[model samples]
Every structure is written in structure tokens, then in C-alpha cells.
Target: MNTSNMDRCLRAALLGIGLALIGAPAIAQDAPVEDAAAPVTESAAAVEPPPPEVQAPSLEQAYQREFAFLQGQKADLERRLAELQDRMGAEQSELEAEIRALEAEVVEMGGEADRLEDRVFESELAVDTARENTDVLASTFLQADFSLAEAYSPDLGDRAPAAEDVSGLFDAALGVLRDAGSIRVEDGEFFLIDGARVDGRIVEIGGIAAYGVSPRGSGVLAPAGDGGLKLWNEDTAEVAEALAAGRAPDSLPIFIFESTATEVEKKGTKGLFDVIRSGGVIGWIIFYLGLLGLALVVLRVVFLQRASASTSKILDAVSGHVRRGDASAALDVLKRKKGSTSRVVSAAIRNLDRDREHLEDIVSEAILHESSHLNRFGAFIMVIAAVSPLLGLLGTVTGMISTFDVITEFGTGDPKLLSGGISIALVTTELGLIVAIPMLVFGNLLSGWAEGIKDDMEKAALRVINQYYEGRARGVESA
Candidate 1:
């Protein structure tokens, strides 16, 4: 039995035992008291005399009776408990069966819900696909309508049908396509290259190309920006005449076009000066500075060339004369030579009889004096190099300012309005770099070369002194 049923049976058994015990105490209390005196009454006293013979129940007898009663109650409770347990068992079986059936139903319902969910998802996907297809169809229809209107007939503007009327639009587009496939000749007045209009037979080979035949001139035709034909500046008169006569020419000369509503102008190449002029005043200043820098470089090159001429040969000849103990001849050779090295060597030769320290000081002084000429224009060239890029940056800042000013005034609607400032910005920067790079490179190189010449001069003067001292020592040794 279940716990609840067992507890109920136990409680019923306890209640039966309690009731038997309580009834035994009540039966003992109801017995007549033997020691108590009977009330005096003639008939009652006679009847009480007979009642005195009645025996009260003994303790053992009373207990035995109570036990017997308890036994009966217990049997009764056991019967009731057995019936309750049987009823409970049947109910439990029924409840378990119902629970199992409910669980099966729940499982079936869950599977159905899953299937419904899948169907819902598939339906949503199909709905989205249909929406996308409709959008594609609408977009394609609108684009086709625009292309037809622009390429074939300007008068067919905005003639798009409703979304449901796709068949009608397709029919119209197909008819226009068929018409555009063949050559058609029409009497029209077209403009010539010189802007003169003349009556002509315009032969159109599809919507792509056209040719004109006229008495004044006959050639291939181009759009004149007014939905009219104009003569192209090409020599295709024979082809135009052949098309006009309905004969296929050996070579087909035609001008293909998309629309005649917009004029097509030929673009010309920009020259160097035109490009420089586009950079405004700053660009021109940079350009002139570049020219001046070039001139300075040339002058510096010439000066350095003259200063370093025949340096090695002069040094060799002077050293040879000094070694032969003829200081006068070496001095004559130095006088004849013309260079910073020569001047330095001559000073050394003149002071050959002096102490070594004095001779060295004299040579250093000569080198320092010649440096004034060797280093000429070097600082200026470097300054120009350093300043050019900064000037370019200045031009760029001004150009950007101008560009922003244009934007502030006109709201940036047209690119052409802003292109001028942008050109100035870019061109000035490019020109600056172009001028500065080579100047910087060549200026450093020239400075290095001048320093090399000075080193050579010092070496030549030192060699002359060394040769003189050696010759004197050799003479002393011979003495």
C-alpha cells in the first residue's frame, strides 16, 4: 500500500483501540457502589435489598471484555482498510494509465507543432523570394523604359506601364528593337562642320550610326546636341553617297553615338606651359626660382672647374722641383699655375726655410683664403633646396583655401569650379619636388667636390714642405 493509505489504516486501528479503552472506563464508573447506603424508602428499600445481590464486574473480567471489544474493532478496521486499499489500487492504476495516455498525446502534439513551424518557415521563405522577384522585375522594366527612351525616341519619355502590364511593355520594346535593326533613309536638315545647315538625305544604319548626303557636303554624321545630325570631321563622303544610294560600300564609315541630346567635344592635350600656368602665381614663382637655381648651379660648376683644374699635375711638377733642391724653380712653377692648390703650394714654397709649425700655419691660412672662392654659391644652392618644398607647401595651403572658399560660395555643385584650385595644389607640389630633389642632390655633391679640392690643396702644400725638408736632410747627410 502507498504511504498515505498505510497511515490512514494505522490511524483507524488506533481510534478503535482508544474507543474500547474509553468504553471500559465508562462501564466501570456506571457500576453501583457497594459501600454507599441506600436511601430510606419502604418499597425502594425492599427493591434495593434484592439489588444488593448483584455482583460488580472484577478488574480482570473488565480487562478481558475490553480486550474482546478491541479485537472486534480491530477486525472491523482491518476490513475497512482492506477495502480502501483495493479502491486505492484501482484508482492508482487508472491514474497511471491516464498519465501515460496524456504523455503520448503531448508527444504527438509536439511533432505536429514542429511540422507546422517548418511549414511556416517555408512559407516565409517563399514570400521573401516572391517579393525579391517582383522588385527585380520592376527595376528591370524601369531601366528598359529609360534605355529605350534615351537611345531610340526622346518623345517616349516616362511611358512606363503598370507592374501587371509587362506584356505590353515587352511588345513595345521588341517593336522598337526591330525598327532599330534596319537602315532607314529620311529627308532631314543637318548641320555641317562649319555650323551651316543644309537639306540632306540622312541614312541611319541602325540607331548606332548615321551618314548624310547633301549637295554642299556629304559625309558621316554625328549628334549636334539638339537631337539633330551634324557632319563629322572625317573623310567619308564615298560611304555616305553609297549608303544614300542604297548600296553597301567597301568600307563603312559611320559615327556611333548613344544620344544626340548632349554634345561631345574632343579633348586636347595640355602642353608644359599650360600645365604650369594652371598652378597660378605660386607655380610661376616656383618655376622662376627653379630657373634661377639652375643658373646658379651652372655658375658654381664653372667656378669649381676653374679652381680644381690640373691640380694633380701642378702638385707633381712642384714636388719634383722641390725634391731636386731647386725651391726657386718650384716657386716659378707655382706662380705659373692658376688654382687654389697652386696658390697654397706657392705659399708653402716661399716659407720653406721656416719651421715646420710656421709652414703648416701658412698653408692653413692659404687654404682658408681659397675657401672663400670654392664655397661660393654652395650655401645659396642649399638654401634654395630647403626653401622650395616649403614654398610648395605654402602654395598647397593657399590652393586648399581657395578650394574651400569656392565650396563655401558655390556649395560644390560642379567639379570644374573646384578643379582649378586642386590643379594648383597638385601642380605646385609636383613642381616643388621636381626642382628641389635634383637641387638638393647636386648641391651636396658640389659641396663635397669643393671640400675634396680643399683637401687636395692642403695635401699638395704639405707634400711640397715634406719634399723640401727631405732634400735638405739628404744634403746634410752628404756633407
Candidate 2:
């Protein structure tokens, strides 16, 4: 049976059973008990009313139903939110992709721009080179009408270029001529002055005359004043205007306006001294001292070397005075001693009277004094030798730093970039060694020579003292 029919049949059977049982309960009431007073009457059995239709719900069931409903709503909301989030994520991804694509396009455009710039630069160089060649060709085909005067300026042929494109040739031409001292870089140009082209050291460059070309063969090169440039047109005997450079402190990097055999002859090979003064304060001081030291060496070799003999003779004279018992005279002679040894002996002689009782004291004092003088410059020479090498080492360290910086900045593809600094550092080291060795050697030799002279002078002074005492003894014997 279907579930609904089955439930109805079961309910009918339960009702019939209840009816049968109800009659039995009624029969059981047939024996009515006698009751006191008011109740001898039989009472019907009490019947319970059918259970009231089940209504409302239990607390647990109510809670469970409410929880289920809330769970269902939460699940629905989660699904909708998830769908919205997924859509947003997709849009974001698309945007990021689009941004990446735009960035790539921008990078490509930048690279294209750089390439185009490089091409333009190359084209400019080519045009410049072409113009220089044109100038050479034109000069080679100079007509009789054309004339060149001072090295600074020259007149060109009357024929102008047929095409406007050909004028670029003059760009290189004018630049070369300007740099050569022929014309001022500021001068605009000398375009066919008086139907002829005149170019030279232009004192003043005027403006492009609205009417083209000046009446006289000369035209304004640019709007006007002068830049003190030497321009000359020897054919016209027109002298160029320029500031005199002869009195400048150092040689300037000026190009020759005119090539003259005499000027080249006069200016022989000039190097570091002309290019730049050694810049650092320390370097400047070192160079100046080097010059002074060089001068001192010359002085010593030429003048002081000759004076040493005279110094020796003075020692001899000092000796003779002591032997003659003229202590005052001997002291005066000692005062005249200027060399290392002489100064030491003079120290002893100055106190001869007090030192007579202890000659050893005299000798000691003199030896110490002489020793100090002899070694005075020796240590200085060694120091100079040491300092030079140290300076070179410092330079090497700095140069290496510079080399590394160059490598970091623009790798080592081109050695030429850093080679010069390295060369300078190495060359400086060599120069330092060259300077130090001779100085150290000479210093040592001079010290040794001074010591030797001091020793000889002391011995001679002692001899003179001994002789004077001997003469006194002989006179005592005669008495």
C-alpha cells in the first residue's frame, strides 16, 4: 500500500481495539459498592479526551530549524561573493597584462628613439666630412680671380654651389679654418662678399646683410664686435686683429694662424711644463723644492767644492797658532773654520784654557759637534728618498682607484681610457727613484767626507797642543 493508505488503516485498527476495551471497563463497573449517605447511585466510567492535535515545537527542534535556514542563506551569499571575486580577479589580470604590454611598447619606442638619434649623429659627421673634402677640391681648382692673403683669411672663387645641399660642405671648411686661427669661431660666415668669397682672420663678424655682400670686397661676418682673433689676407695686405700671446705665462693651446718656419723653429718640443702646472699643492711644493735642490747641487759642485781646500788651510793655520802658544790667536783662527770638522775643532779651541787640564774633554766635545754636522744632511737625504717613493705609491693607489671606477662605470673594453693614468703613476715612480738614488748617495758621501775632515783636524789640533808644551819644557831646561 502507499504510505498514506497504510497510515490510515493502522489508525482505524487502533480505534476498533480501543472500542472493544472500553465496553469491558464499563462492565467492570456493574458491581457498584454501597456508599454512605449520598451515593448509592452508579457512576459512568471516566473517559479521557482524544489527545489534542500536536502543536508548536520542542526547543531543540526550533533551534535546529532556525540554524538550518541561516546556514542555507550563508552558503548562498558565499557562492555569490565568490562569483563576484572571481570576476574581479579576471579583470585585474587583464589590466596587469595590458599595463605590461604598454610598458613593453614604451621600451621599444625608447630604443627606436635612441637608434634614430645615433643615425642622426652619424649623418651629421658624414656631412661634415664631405664638406671638408669639398673645400679641398675647390681649393685645388682655384681660378686666377681667387686670392689668398694672410694665413688667417683667403678669397674664394666666384662660383657658388648650384644646389642648397652643397652648402653643408662649408660647415666643415669654416670650422677647420676657424680652429687654425684663420677666422674666429664666432664669425657667422663670409658668404660671397662683393660677388667674391673672402675669408680670413676676421676681427669682427657682422650680420647677414639683407642686401647680400658688402660694396667693398669685405662683408660683415656676424653681428658685431671683435674676438681678438688674428686674420690676415696677405694678397690685400690686410692685417688680422688678435691679442698678442707672446707675453703669456705658459704656452696656450692656440693653433697657428699662419705656418711659418721661424715660429716652428723657435718653439721646440714643449711638454708637461707648458700643458699644465702640476695641480696639487703638495705636487707644487715638491716641484719647487726639486728645483731648489737642483740649484743647491750646482752651487755645491761649482763653488763650495773649491772652498773646502781653503777650509783645510784654515785648520792648518789654526794648528800653527796653537803651536806658537798664542791661545787667543788660535781661537781667532778656529772662529774662521766653516766646514764640519772645522766647527768641531773650533768648539774645543774656544774653551782651550779651561780644557787644558783635561784634553780628553776637549776632544770629546769637538768630536760630538763635528759628528752632528756631518750627519745633519745625511738623514734628510734618506728622508727625501723615502718620501718620493711614498708619493709615487700614493699616486699608484689613486690611479688604481680611478682605474677600478672606470671599469665599474664603463667596463674595460677600451684600455685607452685608463692607460694614461697608469702610465703617469708608473712614470712618476721611476722619476722618484731617479731623483732619490743620487741624492742619497751624495748625501752619504758628503757626510763621510765631513767626518774624515773632522778627524784630521782634531788630530792636528792635538799635535799643536803637544808641541807647545814641549817648547815650554825646553825653556825650563835652559833655566
lDDT of each: 0.83, 0.52
lDDT of candidate 2 at residue 407, scale 0 to 100: 85
Worst 10 residues of 1 by lDDT: 152-161
Q: Model 2 compared with the native: what TM-score?
A: 0.38
Q: Which structure among the candidates has the greatest TM-score? A: 1
Tens-place lDDT digits, model 2, residues 1-479: 24465446555655555566556644545533322333433332245533454344444564466556655756676788789999999999999999999999999999999999999999999999988877765664352113223222323446633443244444544554565543222332343422344443233221111111222333222211232222122222111212111122232222332322121122456465532132233344445545554554554444335434655576567666665567788767766666655665565566556647686577767677556644544555556756766665665566677678888888889998877556555655655565667766766666666566556757755766575676666668878
Model 2, stretches more than 4 Å misplaced?
1-286, 292-307, 332-357
What TM-score, over all chains together, does every model reach? 0.63, 0.38
lDDT score, candidate 2: 0.52
lDDT of 1 by residue, 166-250 (tens): 6656767887888789999999988888889999899987788889899999898888887988898548988898888988889
